[model samples]
Target: MVQRQQVVMFEIKKASEAEIAERGDLADKVADALARAGFAVHRDVNDASGALGAMAWADPADDSGGGVFVRWLIDPAFSRAAVQSVQQGDVESAAFKHFSTVTEQMYAALLAILTSAGFQSEDADDDMSPYTIRVKG
Candidate 1:
């Protein structure tokens, strides 16, 4: 079977105009936090292929054949981050299931980390459809 990637988008909810004005700095703070938690931060496409803004990858030591990638969107009007799993080679049903389970665990852990870093975050939907996280600034 073909492997499919799972994505979790994080949208920042600005608390004030000052927060909105400091979106770039906020993005950098998030990147720093993730880096401290063992993610490799990439600031350019050259650092990470096809990346439009900042990108980060979970440590290779945590890879279960599929690693997690995080893209930090620095747009002033709509700052956000997107976390996703790297698609792996085609595999059997059992392997695919294992990958999905592991990916979910990784997502959960990431959410916890973000929240612990003082970002008020929650899943956009109760059932987690679309896998979006609303982060309060």
Candidate 2:
């Protein structure tokens, strides 16, 4: 049987004007970290507002009992240049191509980046939920 595991979740909030400038760079770093830790990362965007984001997941081929996943959403307030950068696309593609089952390292790296940037952790309670990219097997 296939079971899904929640490794980590970040309730990312909208970025302010000044923080928008750094969103692209931070996204790139997170994507790179996920790739290095062995995940198939996918770059995504919000259709309505065009917010950028990425998702990474553990591969099933490795015979791990459960799956691990991580995803994040960039603040919609970010500029178009940062939201639609060629570098971001390339980095995301490269990360997506890396498929391995090692999930702990990816979780640690991703958690570090998000927490360092002051992104909120997921709320166990529903009433306090915030904007986020949720990942699950």
Highest TM-score against the true fold, candidate = 1
TM-score of decoy 2:
0.30
Candidate 2 lDDT over residue span 1-137, tens digit each: 99999799865444444444344444455456655655445644323244334463332322222123344434454333343544577525433333111233444556665555454433122233222322221
Least well predicted 10-residue stretch by lDDT in candidate 1: 77-86
Task: Give the Cα lDDT of each candidate.
Answer: 0.49, 0.41
On a 0 to 1 TM-score scale, where does candidate 1 land against the true structure? 0.45
lDDT value, residue 7 of candidate 2 = 91
| Tens-digit lDDT string for candidate 1 (113-136) | 778999765654525333434444
Determine the C-alpha RMSD for candidate 2 after optimal superposition of all C-alphas: 18.2
Give per-candidate clash totals.
0, 0
Instruction: Quote each prediction's TM-score.
Output: 0.45, 0.30
User: Could you tell me which residue pairs clash in candidate 2?
Assistant: none
